[model samples]
Target chain A: MAEKKRELVSGSRLVDENSLKERLIVIFTKWEVILAVLIVFEFILFSNLSPYFLDYFNLMNSTFTFMEKAIMALPMIFIIMSGDIDISIASIIALCSFSMGFASSHEIGAAGIVIIGLLAGLSAGMVNGFLVTSFKMPAIAVTLATQSIFRGISQAILEDQAYTKYPEKFAYFGQGYLGETLIPFELVLFLVLAAIMGFVLHKTQYGRKLYAIGNSKEAARFSGVKVDRARFINFTLMGLFCGISAVLLTSRIGSTRPNIALGWDMEVITLVVLGGVSITGGKGNLFGVLMAIFLLGYLKFGMGLINLSAKVMIITTGLLLIIAVLLPGFLDTVKARRKLRRQQKESGMVEV
Target chain B: MSIPTSIKTITQRRETSLILLIGVLLFGVTMRAPNFVSVTNIERIVNDTSILIMVSIGQFFVILTGGIDLSVASMIGLSGMSAAMINQYNPGMPAGFVLIIGMLIGMVLGMINGAAVAYGKVPPIITTLGTMSIYRGMTFVISRGQWVTAHEMTESYMNLPHGNFLGISNLIWWGIVVSVIMFYFSKYTKRGREIYAIGGNKVAAKFVGVEEKKIHMTIFTLSGILSGIAGVMWTSRFAAAVNETAAGFELQTVAACVIGGVSIAGGSGAVVGVVLGALFLGIINNALPVINLSPFYQMFIQGAIVLVAMLINTLSEKRREQELLKGRQQ
Candidate 1:
């Protein structure tokens, strides 16, 4: 099987006359290109589905629906790329938001509240990192436990009450737009953070180490990479982003409840995975994730415009996740089969 | 220095630690509320834990193969709702038939998951996660946003769980029967050993002629069936069925398995350990209300216990590995 794959690759390379069809196939095979096409296709489909979808104001506003999750997805790429996962992010958001709400209720200044929220998130992340690194626990199990703990703490603190009295200026973070441009402040923040994360993930030695570790932790460790430290940093980075998202989410909603951001972790993970990041790690890019965020954001917006219930939307997202993970492998198998058939035909013809 | 003796010692030590932890928890709770030890309370705790125990056994098989079924809770909801709907419309149907139908519903869903994970080559987590939503959504679609109330249930259906056989709740009897069957199957059956072999080392198992994909399919299907049975039991016990019947129960099952010394990495653990783990959690749940802890603290304590249990499992696992290495060296 390995030899067959190699032969096919070499055979394709030897055929230097690249036809237009072949060129198109090559371009389409690139994940970014396919994603770009899908995004455009979704935009048209959504616009056609709902008359309000095409409105510039609605399109801009829809960005808020997923902006917090998008921000978290930025750091998540690094974590997933490092071959670890953190399902506790949504719980971290709840905890951080609760802390911010508590501070606000106690008459703390806006800046102080934001700082407290961020610190809470940071500490939560640190605990996750500490357990995973020090005890060498599985990342999934550790994060799963922490997710429950963090959410539980938030529940214990808030009970059924929600905190809503934030300073008016707080709304600007989530609700504000640039003068006359229809660009939301939260969207701007996400884009800026995305750029920074993209740069760090693609252009830095640190990013290379992450990929190396993801590919083979033992190999990376033997090669003198501080695998555990890199993972720890990645986890902490995820927490920091979670805190930022919590602040933005709380501000956007204009309240903080213990159950706020429930299940957001799964959504963010879906975004990353749909973006073409391999769940087993060591592959994927920021551009694909960025495109995926828009793809899903617009999808939900379009579906919402059609009056679909949240339950149906959940089903759609779940189906999309399965398809996104399965499609690439399916395509690869198809390609391999076609190649095998072609090889057999050519060999038979030569013998005849 | 022998491998078998060393393995035995490790297993014994793990069970001992679990027992010690359970004792301490019981002692503490009793000190706070002596009434918790009353016969009726103990019976209630045992009865309540029956559903968890059954579901955990199912989860144990999957975990033994180094996989997880995130969709078990959804399976529970679907099966429970299905069973309730059947009972509501067919008041004359036998209760046993309803239970069988529920199990069948679960088996079919599990088969879908198994086929996807085993044949479609999708990751277990992703496949189960997707199915989890799909199944839960199906429950809503089936019920059409309506809940089957206790008043609507047939008298016999409602009485099935409450009815006693030989001085124990029928629910407890079901749990014991399921556990015994699972214990024997895993210990004696060829397919059962295949499950452990695949989980222990997939490559080695394959080399030794184990059909990995088939085993994956079987385990997931079994998990679904168990969840289905639990779903029926849950509906009968509460005499109510809703789309949200077993929300978040999958996590509890996983926690139980981990606490029972089942390695998430797969291929080790016993039915007895799982039963003890369920008992520990059951005691905690029952004692919390008795001891006057706010209901809000339950989630926090459960989460803490899971983390602590996992930590201990990991540490002990490492020590056992070290000991095995030393034995080999000697």
Candidate 2:
């Protein structure tokens, strides 16, 4: 009884009300937290810079624009963490969209469209997974091949013509607002997904397995973590998300062109990395990813508001990606220099 | 001992198999299109192969170090534009100086990529991917998305590649010379060996005091110079430059490298192999258009061929690894 009480006291002290300030301190020191703070800062700055920036209509438009790619990015985070990548996501989305469009032309509605889209994404992902796993081909190589393959299929089906025969209601998934506040349905879906993924990544055993698998597949396998199964599941999940995004993208654009979202895979990766997720994997938070999403969305929106050319926007993204990657290294260098200075001050000489 | 033996056996088989495959493909294409074997068609193939070889040689170096340079297409566009503008803007300027300036522009951009990849520690894919846009974007901004036509190009600059020796295209001669040099450098030079070393094991190389940053910068810059030269050659050939010119050439370059047996994972590839790979792709590219396939279909076929080549290469490599593993056990 005495030992149990002692344990309780120790646990209580760990989460003591007085330690809330200390907790906040910890959060501020974290990279993800810093990113989150920067995003909020940018949001405010943009809102102030342009009256249109904070308008509900604008936000909704941007959210819908980003949703399809963002959804695919969630699974991509897992794939990249495992020391692999899927450059074929954009292609997969194209294939799915094309499949849905094909089905719609055949007079298939709603359910049939969803099924066709999902199957297309699934089969594409399966091919990618099999090629990488069985052939031991680099994920980049496999995905590069599949990117062409899937897009080829899309091209074969649609040729130069686009599909636009979808029913009017389907557009709601992409362009509809929830209530009168101008919050998009797609954005709401994104938030719900973000919340669910956040919970899974931060609070579940399965998420722990993903990190473990990513860090070292051999070790994970030896530990009975089912590494291959996890990867299969991850790829499937990526496909499912791709299918979902297809529905939104096809509807939002109101057509399916072969070149729709030609280079979106890179954009998804940029957001993931910018969100403070390690490209090397085994370490990332959805919170950081969320902040990155908003940060990118707002940055583009702000840049657009300023009337920057599309070319300039492309350059800005490139510069931003480079800066985002280098910032951590720069910070580490600065910290090291400070540490050396402090040590020299204390010891009266720099350590050799 | 067993591993070495099996490796040798596999290498021997691959060499013969690749040679046989090319022969068969050549026969098939020639049978289908009787003109494919003619001197004029051969000339066309050589011309196409020359540009692709130049670009692929650079691509081979980077991919041998397990990195991709998506900026090759943009590099081509930028350098081509620069060369054209220099010739047009500065009348009576020495062709050599203009060429040097164009090459230097490529070098600078390549250096930026190297710095970002090496010192910045950004993934090569992300770095090059970003730079791909930035370079092309800058090209548009500079050119205002305008094309430099033959009227704007100078006569001397156009004359550079038109003068052929030994009944061979000068560009083909250039490709052969560059390939030979690259082949020698990759095989015999210390810097060349150092590149393979970095690709093989960056961590191990670091332990042996190999400066990874320096090597990465060097290779990436070399890639840039090669692409730049191609740009110059391309502009001279067509006497035209546009922002969208050579837009998808990076993928083509990549295809050449991969099909040439340059492992995307880095290490263990030969410059000669890549040159041959470039020739293989060049053949397909040359023949496809003669058959009256639409431009779009041509792209689809080219992409499919690349995918097939990669699949084959990877399958062979995997089989070799399995053999080595099994040999060790035996």
User: Residue by residue across A95-203, what tens digits does model 2's lDDT show?
Assistant: 9999898889999877778788888888878877777776777788877767777887788667799998897777788888887767888888888887777787778
Which stretches of candidate 2 lie above 4 Å from their native place?
A1-29, A179-181, A337-352, B1-15, B159-161, B291-294, B325-330
**In model 1, which residue pairs have backbone atoms overlapping below 3 Å?**
none
Which 10-residue span in candidate 1 chain B carries the lowest summed lDDT?
B8-17
Local lDDT at A183 for model 1? 97
Instruction: Provide the lDDT at A56 for model 1.
Output: 85
Question: How accurately is candidate 2 docked according to DockQ?
Answer: 0.59
Model 1, span B182-293: residue lDDT tens? 9998989999999999999999999999999999899999999999999999998888898788888888999899889898888898788898899899999888878887
DockQ of all predictions against the true structure, Cα-based = 0.71, 0.59
TM-score of chain A of each: 0.93, 0.86
Q: iRMS values in order, in angstroms?
A: 1.0, 1.7
Tens-digit lDDT track of model 2 for B1-330: 699978877666544556677788778887778878888777878777888898898888899888889889899889889888889888799776777888898898899999999889987887888898889888888887788888888888886666679988788888889898998999899899989999999899889888989988988898888888888888888888878879868877887777777788998678777777778877876766666654455556666777787778877777778988999999
